[model samples]
Target: MARSDIRRSAPSPRGGKSSKEQPRGWRLFFRRLFVWGFSLALIGVLSLAVAVGLAAQSLPSYASLKASQNEQMIVVRARDGTQIVSLGPSYGKWLPTAQIPQVMKDAILSTEDRRYYSHIGIDPVGVARSFYVRYQQGKFRQGGSTITQQLARTVFLNNSRTFGRKVREAVLALALEWKFSKDQILELYLNKVYFGGGAYGIDSASRKFFGHPGSSLSLPEAAIIAGLVKAPSHYAPTADADAAVGRAQVVLGLMVENGKVSADQARGVDLKGIKFAQEGGQNSVRYFTDWALPQLDLLLGENTKPIEVWTTLDLKLQNSAASAIKNNVPAGTQGALVSMDRDGAVLAMIGGTDYVTSNYNRAVNAVRQPGSAWKLFVYLAALEAGYTPATEVVDEPVTIQGWSPHNSGGGFAGKIDVRTAFAYSKNTVAAQLGNEVGFSSVASMARRFGITTPISTVPSMVLGSNEVRVIDMTRAFAAVSARGKSIEPYGISKVTTTDGEVLYTHEARSSVQLVPENVANGITDLLQSAVSIGTGQAAQIGRPVAGKTGTTTSNKDGWFLGFSSGITTGVWMGRDDSRPVAGLQGGHAPARAFAAYMKVAVSGRPVERFQTDMVAPAFQISPDDEASFSGSPDEYYYVDENGNLVEPPADKTAARRPSDAPEDPAPGPDDANRGGLEAVDPPPAASEDFLNKATGKEKSDGTPPN
Candidate 1:
């Protein structure tokens, strides 16, 4: 009975075999099938191992991978060690794994690799899921890479979504897992991932997005940063904060699902408090940084290591300058301001009101007509030609080589002293002075005073017809405040490596003397009068100041170049397209900006007077005589070195007098106080004859007559 039951329960094998034997044969067939399948699976595994090894042979060596870790950032800092900007491929501070906030670590793991701790460099389940997703989508839509794999790819591989790269990435990821801990791999990933806005690594991304450090990141902020690893440009908080926060919400949900945070905690995250980085003040200093960056390359050639640049910029002053320009200047109009010490150490500079909108540095790159400000060199030339502040020159309209220059304010004062002409910015007098001194002499004088712009020998050059940069004009005026010393303006004070090795140091050097002390003093006295009582009155800052105001003919450019005993600053207001700024004049916006900036710039400094003593004329005039001569008739009056009226030598021809001829109609307000006239016909020979007759000798034009 037991044998029959066994035979009934047993399976059949072959045609001639019993039921029991058939069950044995069926078992044998199943076993053979299992062995063949197992053998094929083993061969496939061996083949995959061979393929991985072959891919690994073509990959970069471990030494190169280690060497790639040496990439550093360039940090531009102000004099006070405050960071201004960071520049380089890896533009961020390297943070250690311990320094990274735990929330940030969790956020990264949750979003990038949920099984990061449990997996050995790769996750089979994630790869299979990703493959299914890609197959359904008909494209490679997801990267099934672990954190270790990402670190390997970022350190030694390009970001190409290809099968070969994936193989190499997997091989290298295994190598990284063998060599480093999970924390080590995570730290490398955090320090090397790109977070958009040109930032690389967690520290830079933290500072860029939140204006803080990685160690201080909140959960939401960490989630936001972790979200950026998926697509940096698309999730950049600065460009699209909503997109960034939305992605961060996804990360937060993942974090909660992974048991890293509670659902209540995830819901409690507030993105409102996260202040996205702005391109305003953080980038306002970029104007100065841009100017100073090239100089660093010049100072330290071909340097690959990270360098710290210590600039002369006072961030406070820089901020003030930018604010003043933004608040004071008209919207469509652009402005530039540069401030420097008497020794040419640039203290503050703003190339444009908004650096992000336009990076063109007007202070250092723009070359526009300075108008009456160019008269400084003209007057300087006259002083060098033995003309003192008390010397008299006719202010009537004058023409040279077809360039007829008219005085600002239209009507002439009949005749005036050189000091009065300069103070009032009388264009005719400046042109006549240019003629008397010869245009070449004025051009040479400008070159000597640190104007690097090309100057033409045209007579209108005396009225600032020649274009110039604000920095050049500021440097020129600095020489005046420095008592005629030549100045070379510079921004960077020192440069050093992050490791504290000195790369470059700008030595504080004495300036070269360009103008005679007496001549400089005389010029300073004239310009000081301009600020105190003339067109530059708007630039007055309660304390003594010396500067000039200039407006181009069509109001295309306006300028205020002034200086105290300690600092010299120049301001320019104009349009980028060279179009006229409506109602813009040097005495208006430019002067106002200059005054506002100087008031803040000199707040803490003691009020110091200019060197008036050095400006004492070679000859002195009696107080009573100077007073009595103020209301004298409109006749040509000759003065000697002592500023006393003197008769011409009897042996020379008698001085000619201006006839009672009717004067030309007065100029309109638009014509008066403008930059000046353009090229016109040469003045009548009779005018020179009159001068020759008055001096009782041939006219001295500062050149040998042909």
Candidate 2:
């Protein structure tokens, strides 16, 4: 019994462990394996937390993100609601979530992420597919970022392909998803999204490209805007219209597959209608926009919020003007053209031959000599003193302050009426008229016509001897076109934000008549003769045109400025360095271009004839003028087809009066427009090929083809 008890009591367990005893079986192996896995998983979780913490530290806040972008971009639009240009970085008012078109949202979701609502900040299925694509292609070719993730990256991160950036993007995306609702995240994303051409935010882009708000977007328009997110520069509607349409079609197909719209519905959306609203816009428009940029501060008062400047620029007219200058301005020189309404609203401005070649906005900036074009004021001064276009004046040579001024053609009719003298561009008679009217009165007349440039009160001031901007010159003529009303040249008609809040609006003030009605009518009559029977005949376009030609000595500057079809336009030609062009004339290519541009600019507008009839104060003709009217008034001169100063043919002279003779006349030109040289009214030297662009026929020598 003692031996059995000892064996039982000391019964050493079996070689292997029992079920409840110290286990040495699969259970223990599994327990140890689970413990090791748990510890490793905990370590990995902590490591991921630390990495995410580091990434979150660098994330940018909304305020900081906004601060780095453009303070306020200026989006200029034409009067017809076409975008002229987009300048500065786009930072605009937030577009409400409701205003974001449903179609646009659907299009984005379909193209970017199908499971956007259900997916976490990081899309797992997308990640798997991305990984598969990487494995198959041996590199990361596809992205797995959800909408939330994209927003995080756009707001907080620079575009970098580093793995660390990817990790940070994921962490920030998670943080965004936790902090904001899906709609809020989407709103933020759309606002910060860059759609190119300095466009940011869907609303700004909509106004920029469509000339409307996002809330009014059509289906195809929405698809087009949505498609821009992938490759902004490559797919911007203005950049590559065809590519943008194709991408939009692809987006539509994706939308169809995603069930946002039926296949029929998507197909019904006209991709053909997805055109950019910036019609008639060209790179040359940079000149106008550049001119308008500085005025923003004046209009907006230091408010740098994104704004839409509604300008008076007519893009269609602008394009025509640009084409006219491009086709007419010859090599080795530059040209500028500006057109405005009768009330001084600037419609079009072309600064140079090519905006790419030079951005010097000669229209608004360049202050150059205006030559005989200043005769408008001289004649206006004479009219104010009761001189009519028909009033008689002796066309004899004159000397003023020891300066002798001669005709551009080097001759003067022995005795002629004032009309004959002015029509023939008789310089001697212009000097007589300037002396009769008083030089200060002539300068005052110019000032009254809105000429802000400094006009010398000296006797030479009777000739256009002041350096002036093309716009200012155009403005002076514009006042005349408005029947002697005071003019203030303005471009911006209204200023608004991207959300349609108007900041500034152009107000039409009371019209200030710079001249009496009769004087205005008399001056208009004089200008009419200048274009009809004078040097500016080429500027006529199947209608009554009234303008003047001005050429500085040595042809340093050539100008054709006038009014027709209720619009006042001006064209200037010269080298920027003020070097002489051998034979440039105000009536040459400049007149041709004015006609070319006006032909298109006046199309579809009602024909408005000039007010020629007026009550005038009768003035007695000087005894010498009365004496000169009788001695062979038939000895009138004209620029024949050969550009020579020749007397009319015997038969033509017998049949024609001085008003019927084609005369390229000039005003007093001793102190020629700020050119500091004697005014020389040479015949047009470049009319040979000027008509080919408009009439499609070569002109005969230097004669006008019309």
Candidate 3:
């Protein structure tokens, strides 16, 4: 600032020598301006040179990174080491130059790179021709992405189809040219391109589209496979056979034009009749894969990219389950099945009534209220809290915190034993027990048994008000069948690289015992009674079996969950529109379907009997028989020979109340309205060993006990 200021202040030099001699100051100023402009120009040239040098030095590395990364693909294999699926960049396999079919090579070269072998990596003639054609079309239509350029874009670059990306691709293509030989780049490109439909490499496409591997493709098939490179879905054999043939014809034309095939040979080709499997299309097992994909992704996280998920799914079991539902469930009814081993390995899962029509996977996706089946948890809570199976519980109508529960049939049996109450699904009894044992305890017990959904500790919890997925409920019941161990279901067993490098392995978590063996056995015994004489009669298998039937209120949902010695199977029937099923109670079609599936699912396996513990506290003459007094309509009371009622002390006065303030009113016409009927809740009808609550004492005269 000071120098410029001084110069400006010094001013324009006007020498007085002569007017013609004139301004020496102006000449000096012009000379200085010229020098400054020259210096800036030299600096600009140096900067450009430096930038070019830096790019030249680092560009190769970027191109190399792209090439290497794009070449490596993550192959997902089954536990048996078979490639079940893959997420690769290419549509085909990476084979040596000689392994690729001559027809396929010729087809790709004739269509994609006419001068692939002649030119380095780029062809200026082709570029100019394509440029002129696109300009004449008034749109950016044609692109001259050489084989190398296409490979570069696929393996290393973003999928931006813009001019800048195109330019970058071209630059990378030339860089690849200088880095590798023509055959090397071609081989890499052939193995690293996408043929669409999740077919990453050329070998996969040949196997998928032609029903043959890359090494076995016929001329016409190879031509078609090569044609798919242009647009896979648009010209896919499955999507449009005629269009694919048309594309093949264009490829054949190019082949002949490039001298790769004779014109007569191309014309004589009668290869227009290729067809693909319609059932699976190019994507086989879409339903099963879609179902397992999210689960696999969640379990393996970053490792899922290359991991294969091998499930315990028996294809036969799946087919049988689906067929059973189709054959039995009424038309317009939707259902699902969850079948698992006693060890918790899910053998088969059928999500919807039909996965083909609906992608809704009801096995794991749909969460519906479980209805009375949830009573199992309430019973489990009581059993764990030192309550024996013979424990007496009143079945009278009771209210819990303002929620009055009605029986499934709208009546109570007064008092009942644990087994009868559960087997009969006495709603009032279950609610009373749920409240007595604490709803939180029941909810906690359900959680320990693998119910992941939120459980509410309300009185309705006893009625299966909690929502649970079919799979979750199946897994929970599997614990009982598994002999008191929790079984977390899993699909994939192991994962490895394509080259057999062991990447990751999934080990089964050891069985966790969440319930005492005796308690679980007791629960299973009670459920066995359900199948034998109670609500789950439809689940009666010839062999010893145990299960529970669940029919939610209003027939909105029905379920049959059961287990044989070997497998636990759950069946659900409902409607997609959420309409009530037509007479579809849990004990009806759902239980029948479950038994039908299990009868075959567990065939040939010897039954392993459930173990029960007798160490539980024994009651005196069965708690259900603590009192017995028969009354008749004639106002007659049949008293036992010993004394008042039954089992009374000698000194006790049976007819006398304590000498208190007031006595109970006598039975009279007006007393009935005054609460003087003296209706005492009778004890559960005790039997010699077990009591039938309905008939007072287990029918001593040999009337069969309920």
Candidate 4:
């Protein structure tokens, strides 16, 4: 061996390596370095294994993975399919793997975990890419979680950035893959994941955003929902529809890239086609939603599952009602209004001027004096007892049970017919009619009218002293407009589960005719006179109106209740504390609000005139009677407790303007109908327990307790 010829001679630069023959040191050094490197790698792998085992010990069992949930949600929708509000965490009915829309599955798979089917719960390639991205970007910018890993995190582990949490997540991921099939994992992830806006599942997200169920989701809708999993709040369709759609666009692009969706299908999606659901925030529709909630218990007996309350709320009318109150009612006063169809389906309701500030629904909740409005029942009772609109009555002061009621004008008119007395809303005449009709009969008439509130059986009740809810009063009037058919105000038409299972359906409490058609006709004529040419002139719209006005003592409460041929509504204005609103009167704020709301509410319906066939008057007003009356044909008289027409005193006022009418205490620019809040027993319908449990069923409008 020639040292000069050997390759070791090249290492002569280091004197020790110059001896090429003795190469063991260099070989030994290389061998030891390799051995140390292998040993460190093995130690690192063992340490990771041990760490993974420790993490596995702390993780929850995959056997317990399930579609967990919190409280059930209640979704209240309008008659026209408008979602009014969602009560709690909304979870749609669970969708089985086979039932899940294929587009949804494709969207999720393409955008979330393209290699999900091929992976064992965790994607090594994805993890490596994620770490590489972090290394390149110098921060954790994106997650590399597979669908299974994400499910494990959302179901079994809390989202955390700690290394131990990551290890535990990985271990759970493996366990989930072992325990669940790919389809099961996908189904679990979709049905249990949060999609923001208190929606916990795809079905709920579909309904929450698109106003439909999971089975009805479109491609765009599915993509939008699928994108929510990454950042629920950031991509919630209800929050920012544009951002959600933008995220959906990205998802669709990924779907197309992954061959899950066709390019043509992706391109055809219209940006304008997608609309996010928005309900119950700042929009006055909250009034109806807030009202219809508690009734669920009475409706379905402590329902806890997700349900849809099919309500009779007309969004159009509801908006109109809110606008009417907010635009017409004075700043310091709160206003409430409820409108219903002839069948008693509540079309719209306004609990207060601003429901956001005050949730107490004055429409169905508050019971106040319905001054002259109570005259409806009294007059109805008189008519029922064979009294006619033309029946003569004295306007003189009358005393009953030690209670003497005077004309609001402070002076009595000479002589007036029954129609005139009712039209002018003369308080003295109403008291006399109540006495003559027999307070018992008057109370009975009110009871038959569906008002269930406590009625003062006292003599003053005839003078509009009964405190009654607006709904009860409205219903009393509704009976008149409906020709004496029983009317019950109902907000919910039906209750159903998310799976379309029917729970409860509303039925009219009573089908029995409470008032005779003739009496109703007579009452309707009086109401027509009150609105057409009488005190209710302020409530008149272009179409015919039959309504009355009511004001409590000291103007503490003002109310106006009216109905057209098809729809009925009641309005009340007052302070929540029962304090009087200065200058408030039924003919003013209430009438104005009623007119404003009806102008929009009925504008879309055909003009249906009220029934014109009024009952025959017992004392028919003849042209000859107008020609020759007993005392100065202009004389307005009053009826005593015995139903005798009493002559007016010499000092009695001859002619009078309606401004000082007792019922409409104050006539503003909106002077016409003035309802005197009369304390009366609520008509029978007001106390319908099944329906009334819904505070909103305070439920029908009134002309009686006005």
Deviation (Å) of 327 in candidate 1:
4.2
Find the candidate with the highest TM-score and give its number: 1
- Compared with the true structure, what per-residue lDDT tens digits does model 3 show for residues 1-706? 9998998777366663334644478797888889998999899768745643454455555344323543434444333444545554434445777998788788888888888877755688788888898889976565776898887787668878788887667666766776678877777776667775656567877766766678767778878878888898788776778888888899888898888889899988876666664423212233445555566555655652233345555665666787767777866888888888866666777777655578787777788998988888888767755566777766766677899999888888766678888889898888767766566656656765667666666568789987888887887788888766767766555555444555546676655555556677888888888998899988877887788999887798999998887688888989877788779899998888887887888776897776655343222234454233121111111112111122223333433234452321222343211211122221122232322433244443456646
Cα RMSD, each candidate: 13.0, 14.9, 14.4, 16.0
Off by over 4 Å in 4: 1-73, 91-176, 202-282, 302-305, 604-706
- Give the clash count for model 3: 14
Per lDDT, the best of the predicted structures is 1
lDDT of candidates 1 onward, in order? 0.76, 0.74, 0.68, 0.74
- Cα lDDT for residue 3, model 4? 68
Candidate 2 lDDT trough over 10 residues, lowest sum: 676-685
| Per-residue accuracy of model 1 over 254-340 as CA lDDT, tens digit each | 999999999999888897678876644555688788877887667888877767889988889888888778777876999999999
TM-score of each: 0.77, 0.64, 0.74, 0.64
Residue-level lDDT tens digits of model 2 in 1-706: 9998888777456874446567688989999999999999999889877766665565566556544453567778999988767677764556668888898889888988789889767899999999999999999887988988888777767888999998878888877766567877787777788887678878778877887877777889889988998899999887988898999999999999989999889878888765577655356788988887678787778785668899999988888999898887757989999899866688999999788778889988898999888888777766666566666555555677887787788876765654555555667666766766566556646654556556676666666677777887887788778777666777889999776899998887656545656677877887888888988888988887888888888899999998887899999999999999977888888999999999888877777778877573222234234223211213322222211123335564344325433332233553223221111111111232322321334332545446
User: Candidate 4 on 1-706: residue-level lDDT in tens?
Assistant: 6865787546445555634565488898998899999999999878766665565565444344443555677888899877767778877778888888999999999988999999987899999999999999998776899998887887767887899888778877876676557888898888888999899889888887887889878888889999988899988976888788889899999999999878999999885587766554545677777767677777788666678889999887888899899888876888888888888888988888877677787877787888888888888877755566876666765567788887666888746777888888898778866765567556656655666566556788876677777777887787678887767667888888877899998876544455556667778888889888877889999898889988788888888898985889999888878887888888888899999999888887888776646543322333344324222213322222221223434543433324343421222432111121222211221123312211222323422222
- What is the Å distance of residue 530 in model 2 from its true position? 1.3
With candidate 3 superimposed using the best TM-score fit, by how many Å does residue 365's alpha carbon deviate from the native?
Answer: 3.3
- Candidate 3 residue 88 C-alpha distance from true site, Å: 7.3
